[model samples]
Target: MAKRVLILSSSPRRGGNSDRLCDEFLRGAAEAGHQVEKIFLRDCTIHYCTGCGLCSREGRPCPQQDDAARIIEKMVCADVIVMASPVYFYTMSAQMKTLIDRSCARYYTEISGKEFYLLLTAAEPDRQLMLRTVDTFQGFFDCLEEAHLRRSILCPGVWNVGEIEGHAALQEACEAGRNC
Candidate 1:
């Protein structure tokens, strides 16, 4: 069966380590006969959430009109969600965090119950340190009922744009996506 796979690449810079892995994942998933689409947050005009509390109030809709709602709608429709981010300051990038915050309106109703796969990259070499970023994602995962974290590929010790190139983790990402 062909599954709908939506990949959110949150790297502020295109072709960044995590984003590169997302490309590989896309390639593998496509070869596996899945309908895959990747959303590069860098290209999207995502406005910061204003916390107006309207979206929670009976279809009042978000006061700020931007790409967030559209992205959330795609997220709601996807069978698999790949969240790829480059970790900085021991956490996800600001773009990814902003997207999560913007989803506050439809989180419970729309963003829950999907298979999640994480692709994270960081300069820190220690896997334990990288797990901190995964832990951060776990906090978000805990809020979404039935959100299964199927797998995660963490690429540490990568700082430059092309630093992660040719790494074995890239192949692992392809394999993971193919299996999905």
Candidate 2:
């Protein structure tokens, strides 16, 4: 069945390892006949969450008038959500974290029943280094009912831009999207 796929690429650098993987994933998802959209965090103006609790207390809109609400709305509508980030100090990038935090306004209701995928890249070669990042994503998953983590691609040992080019993990990412 055709699905709506939303990809959040949180790499600060354009064409970075994780961003490249996101591109490949988009390609595969498109080829598989899914409607796909990729949002690059570097180009979006997402403000940090201030934790004012306004969203929770009064069901009010987030105080910050930025692109986050629109992005979260897209996330809410997607059947599949792919979060791709370059690992920084064995964790997801700050931009990705901020985006996740900004979803608090609709976390309880808008974000649910989606198939989630994680694409992480880091300088460390050990796959174990991504465990904490996975846990962080799982923490977000725990808040959303019926949301399932369908797959993850940890492309480690690639720090420099363009280093992910020609890597087998790119193909794997594409396959993951194609099979989604």
How do all models score by TM-score? 0.96, 0.97
lDDT of 2 by residue, 46-123 (tens): 999999999998889898999999999999999999999988876789999999999997855678899999999988
State the displacement of the C-alpha of residue 40, model 1, in Å, after optimal TM-score superposition. 0.4
lDDT, each prediction: 0.90, 0.92
Off by over 4 Å in 1: none
Of candidate 1, the 10-residue stretch with the lowest lDDT total is 104-113
The best candidate in terms of lDDT: 2
Per-model C-alpha RMSD: 1.1, 0.9
Lowest lDDT 10-residue stretch of candidate 2: 105-114
Error of model 1, residue 57, in angstroms? 3.9
